[model samples]
Target chain A: MIRFEEVNFAYGARSVLRSVSLSVGFHERVAVLGGSGEGKTTILKLILGLIRPDTGSIIIDGDDITRRSESELRETRMKFSIVFQEGALFDSLDVKENVAFCLREYTDMSEDEINARVRHILASVGVEQALELMPEELSGGMHRRVSIARSLALDTPRMFLYDEPTTGLDPVNADNICGLIAELSKNGKGFIMVTHKVSDALKVADRFIFLRNGSLLFDGNRHELLNSDHPDIMIFINEVCIQGPSGA
Target chain B: MDVKRTISDLQDFYSLSLHGLLGIAGRPFYFKDALLQMDYAGAGSVVIVVIVDLFVGMALSLQLAAELSSLGLKMYIGMIVGISVVRELGPVVTALVFTGRVGAGMASELGSMALGHQVDTIRVFGLDPVKKLVTPRIVSSLIMLPALTVIGVAVSLLGGYYIAVFVSHQSGTVYWTSIRNILTVENVLAGASKPFIFAYLISSICCYMGLSTRGGSVGLRQATTRAVVMSIVMIIVADFVLTRMLLYVLGFSV
Candidate 1:
C-alpha cells in the first residue's frame, strides 16, 4: 500500500500540491483524472520517491521512503515499476536488452536465464517478434508494449505507475493498453494510471480520483463517478464519449 | 564555511569524478570509441595546425636566421627550432585544436542527454551517468592529447627543418647535429607533460558545463559554446601557471 499524508510540494515560488493527502491500497486499479498541469504526474513522482514532499511523509509498504538513502531507495524501488509517457526505452539498446535491463541489473540470472525471462515477458506482452528490434524501429504501440514487458520483468508485488500510458496511441492501441491495465489488476497488481482519457478510465479503473489545483476533488468507485451529478465529471464524459473519436 | 558542508561538497565532487574515472577504467577495450573521438579531435583539426605551424615555423626560422647571421650565430637555427617546437608549440597547439574540436561536441552531447531526461533515467535505473558517460571521455582525451602532441612536435620540427635547411640553404648535417646537440630530455618531458593536464582540463570543464545545462535545446547550445571557450581559456591559463611553477621548481629563471 502507498499513502501520502498532507503532502506539500512546490516549484520555486509556486505551490503545486498544497497539503494534499491520498492512499492507494494493494491491487487497487486507480485512475487519476486531471487536466493539464494538475500535478498528477508530480503525485506519482512523490510516491516513487523521485521527489520528496516539502512538509509531509510518503509511506510505501510501511516505510517512510522520503528520508531513505539513495542505495536504500534504489533497493526498495525494485518493488515497483513505472511506464513513462514516452516509454523512455533506451534508443541505443534493442528490445530484448531494454526489457532485460532491470533483470540484468538487479538479478543474478545468467545471460541464458535473462534471455529466457525476456522472451517470456515479451511473449506475455505480445511482442515476442520484436526481440532484436531497436526502439527507434518499433511503432508507438510496440514501444509501449515493450516498456510494459520491461516493467513486468521484476514481478514484484507492489505497484505500477503509468504516466499517460495511452497518449499517442490510436484508439485500438489505447483500448488494448486499457484492457492490459484491467487484466493486470484482475491478476492482483496495484495500478495508478494518470490520463486524460475518460473512456479508458471508465473502462479500466475500479475507482476514479480527480485532481485539480493540486487537490483531490473526487475519489470514489467507477459507478459513483458515472452516476454522480458533478458538472465537471459530466462534462468530461460528454466531451470524451459524445464528441466523436477525438479522444485518441 | 561550515566544515561539514565543505566536506560534503568535496565528497560529492570526488565521488562523481571517481565514479566517472572507474567506469572508464573498467572498460579498457573501448578502443574503437577512443579512435573515433581521436579522429574527430585530431584528424579533423590537422589542417588548421598544419597551416599555422607552416607559417609560424617559416617566420620563426627567418627571424632566427636573420638574428643569428648578424651575430655570427647562424649555426643555432636548428637549436631554436628544436627548443621552440618541443617545448611550447606542440602541446599548446594540440590542446587548442582539441578544445575546439572535441570539447564542444562532448558538451553538446551530454547536455542534450540531460535535457531529454536520459541522464535522470540512467540514475533512476541505478547507473551513475557520470561514470557511464564521462569517464571514458576523460581517459581517452588524456591519452590522445599527449599522443597528438608528440605528432605535432614531429610535424613542426619537419616544417622548421625544411625551411632552415632547404629554403634558407643551410647544411643538413648542421641542422641535424645542432638539434641533437641542443635539445635535452627535460625539454621533451616538459612538452609531453603539458598535454595530459590540458586534456584533463578540457574534459573536466566540458563535462562540468554539460552537466550544468538547464532549459532545453538552446541551453544546451549555450553550454556547448561556453564549454569550448572556457576550456580553451583554462588550458592557456593552466599552461602558464603550471609552466611557471615547474620551471621555478626546476630552478629555471624564466
Candidate 2:
C-alpha cells in the first residue's frame, strides 16, 4: 500500500535519507529499527509529506506524493495517521476536543455525535472517565493512548505511522501497545513503526528494516534477523535478549 | 546575526503574518478559538490594564500638577494630561502592557505547543497551523488592543480630572472644557490608529517566535522572552513611526 523508490532527502548540506527504498503491504506491520539519530523518524516525516524527498518518489497506495502540492498533500495526509513520539495532543484542548479535533475541522458531525465518537475512541483506548481532562492532566501512558485514539479518529485510514511509540514506556504498557498494534493488523490495517525498541518490534512487527547511516542495512523477518550473521544485527538483538542463541 | 540572515528572518516574519491574515479570510474560520483568544487577550487583560493604567494616569497628573503649579499654570494641567494621554501615553502604555502580558502569553503557549509537537499535530491532521493557531490570536489582538487603548485613555482623563479638582483647585467646568476642546476626531484617529498596527506586530512576532522555537523547554523560555522584548521594542518604535505618519496624513502637527 506504500512504496519508497530510491528516495533521497537532505537537511542543509547533510544527507538524512540516501537511496533508501522500502514498502509496506496493506496488512503488513513493518518496524524500521535504528539507533538514535539514524534518521528513522525522518522516513515517517517524508512519507507524510511534511518534508519531501529531494529525489525519487514515495508512492502512497499508488499516488506519487513527492510532487503533491500543499492542498493535495492535505488530501493525501488524511489517508494516514501518525502517533508522534510525544503523543502531540492539542494542549489548549481537553482529551475530548483533542480526539474530536480532525472531525471538528473536517466533518459536519453534530456536537453530540462528535462527543460520542470521542467517547467511544477514548473508551476503546482504555481511557474512560477522562473525557473532560486536559492533555496536561493526563499521564504519559494516557497521552500515548489518547494519541492513538486521535489518529484512529480519521475515517478509512489506509496506513498508520508510529514514531517511537514505545520509547520511555514501561514494559507492561509497551506490551499493551504492541497488542493494540497487533489488533490493528488483525483488522487488516497496515502500519510502519519506527523505533529502537527491539522487543516491541519482535512482539508486533511482521518484518523489520534495520537502519544504519541513513540507509537500510537489514530487512527481514524475526527468524531471519536472529539467525543472520551480521555483526551489528547480532549485537542489537543481544541487547534486546541477553539469552539469544546467537549470543556474542 | 548575519545581515543576510536577518533579512531572511524579516521576510519569514512578514510571510507568517500575511499567511495568518489570510487564514482569517479563508474557510474553516476558527471562531471558537478566536472567541477564546478574545477572552484571553481581551477579557483576561482587565486587571493588569486597570492597575497599570490607573497608576499611569495618577502619576502623569501628579508630575504635571507639581510642575505647572509653580508657574501658576496649574489650570492647564488637564489640558497637558489630556493631550499627552490621547496622543501618546494611552496607546503606547497599552501596547507595552500587552507586550508583557498577552505577547508573552501567546509566545509561551505556542512555544510549548511546538515543543510538545502540537503544531505538527495540526499538520498531521491536515489542518493549517496558521488557521488553527495564529489567526485566533491575530483576531483577538486586533479587537482587544484598541479596546484596551480606549479604556486607558478614559481612565487617564479621569485621573487628570481628579488632580485638576483637588490638587490644582481648578474649576471643574474649565478643566473639563480644556480637555474637551483639545479632543478632536483627528487626534483620536491618530492615537487610536496605533493599537491596530501594534496588535499585529505583537501577535505576529510572538507567533513567529513561538512557532520557530527549537531546542526544548529552554527554547520555549527563550522564545517567550524574545517575543516580549521584541514586541515591546517594536511597539515603541512603531508608535513613533506611526505617530509621524498619522500626524502628516491627518493634518496634525508632528
Candidate 3:
C-alpha cells in the first residue's frame, strides 16, 4: 500500500501540491484526473521518490520514505514502475535492449532466457516487431507501448504509474491505449494513472481521483464521481459529455 | 551571478566529482562504456589536436627562430619550442580543445537524458546515474586527455622541426639534440600532470551541468554553453595554478 499524509510540495516559490492526503491499496485501479499544471503528475513523481515532499510523510508498505536517501529510495522504487508522459525511452537503445535493460542489470538470467522474456513482454504490449527498432522510429503510441513493455519487464513491481499516457495520441489510438491499460489492470495488478482526460480515465480506472488547484477535490468510486455536484467535477464531466468520449 | 547560487553550485559540483571518483572503485564497473568513451574522447580527437598543435608549433618556431637568429641563438629553436610546448602550451591547448568537444558533448547528451526522464528511469531501475554515466566519462577523460596531450606535444615538435630545419635553415641534428636535452624530468612531469586535472574538471563540470538542466531546449542550450565555457575557464585557471604549484613542488626558483 502507498499513503501520502498531508503532503505538500513546491517548486521554488510556486506550490504544486498542497496538504494533500490519500491512500492507495495494493490492488486498486485508480486514475488521477486534472487539467494542465494541476499537480497530477507531481503525485506520481513524489510516490516514485524522484522528488520529495516539502512537508508530510510518504509511506510505502508502512515505511516512511520522505527522509530516505537516493540510494535508499531505490529499494522503495523497486516496488513500482512508471511510464512517463513522453515515453522517455532511451533514444540510443533499441526496443529490445530497452525492455531487457532492467533484467540484464538486476537478474542473473541467461542470454536465451532474457531474450525470451523480452520477446514475451513486447508481444504482450503488441509491439513485438519493434524489437530491433530504435525509439526514434516509433510513433507516439508505439513509443508509449514500448515504454510500458520496458516497465513491465521487471516482474517484482507491485503497482504501475502512468503519466498522461493517452494525452497526445489520436482518438482511435487513445481508445486503443485505454483498452490496453484496462486489459493490463486485470489479474490483481494495480495502477494509478494520471491524466487530464476524463474519458480515458473512466475506461481504465474503477476509482476516480480529481485534483484541482494543487489539492484533492474528490476521491471516490465512479458512481460517487458521476453523481457529485462538485462544480469542478461537474465542469470536467460536462466538458467530456459535450466533447464526447475522446475529449480530444 | 548570484554569489550564493554560485557557491551552492560549486559545492554540488565538488560533491558530484567526489561521487564519481568513488564510483571508479565500486562494483558493476562499466568497462565497455569507458572503452567506448575513450574511443570518442581520445581517438576521435587525434586529427584536430594534431592539426591545431602542428600550426601552433610552426608559428612559434618561425617567430622564435627569427628573433633568436638575429642574436645568433637560432640553433636553440628546438629547446625553446620543445620546453614551451611540453611545459605549458601542449596540455593547455589540448585541454581547451577537449573542453569544447568532449565536455560540450557530455553536457548535451546528459541534458537530453535528464529532460527525457532517462536519468529518473535509471534511478527507478535501482541504478545510479553517477556510477553508470559519470564514472565512465570521468575514467575515459582521465586516461584519454593525457594521451592526447602527448600526441599534441609530439606533433608540435614535428611542426617546429619543419619550421626550424626548412624555413629557418637550422641543422636538423642540432635541433633534435637541443629538444632531447631540455626535456628534463621536472619539465615533462609538470606538462604531463596538467591534462589529468583538466580532464577531471571538464568531465565533472559538464556532467553536473548536464544533470542539473531544467526547463527545455533553452535550458539544454544554456547548460551546454555553460559546460563548454566553464570548462574552458576552469582549464585556463587550473593551468596557471598547477604550473605555479608544480614549479614550487619541483624546487624551481620563482
CA lDDT, candidate 3, residue B49: 93
Candidate 1 chain A worst ten-residue window by lDDT: A239-248
lDDT of 2 by residue, A1-248 (tens): 77999999898788888899988786788999988888899999988898889999999878998988777888778878999998988887899888888888778999989988998988888897889999889877888899999998877678899999888888778778777877777777888999997777887887999988899899999888878788877778876676332211
Q: After superposition, how far is residue A75 of candidate 2 from its true place, in Å?
A: 1.2
Model 1 scores a C-alpha lDDT of 0.79
TM-score (chain B) for candidate 3 is: 0.97
Off by over 4 Å in 3: A243-248, B1-4
- Model 1: DockQ vs. true structure: 0.33
**lDDT of all predictions:** 0.79, 0.86, 0.92
Displacement of the residue A17 alpha carbon in candidate 1, Å: 2.1
> Any runs in candidate 1 off by more than 4 Å, and if so which?
A107-116, A184-187, A228-231, A243-248, B1-15, B22-77, B171-183
Fnat for each predicted structure, in order: 0.12, 0.73, 0.76
- Per residue, candidate 3 scores C-alpha lDDT tens digits across A209-229 of 999989999999987987889
How far residue A132's Cα lies from its native spot in candidate 3, in Å, is 1.1
Looking at model 3, the pairs that clash are none
DockQ of each: 0.33, 0.75, 0.84
Error of 1 at B32 (Å): 10
What's the TM-score of chain B for every model shown? 0.83, 0.96, 0.97
Q: Residue-wise lDDT of candidate 1 within B75-102, one digit each (tens)?
A: 7898888888777877887788778878
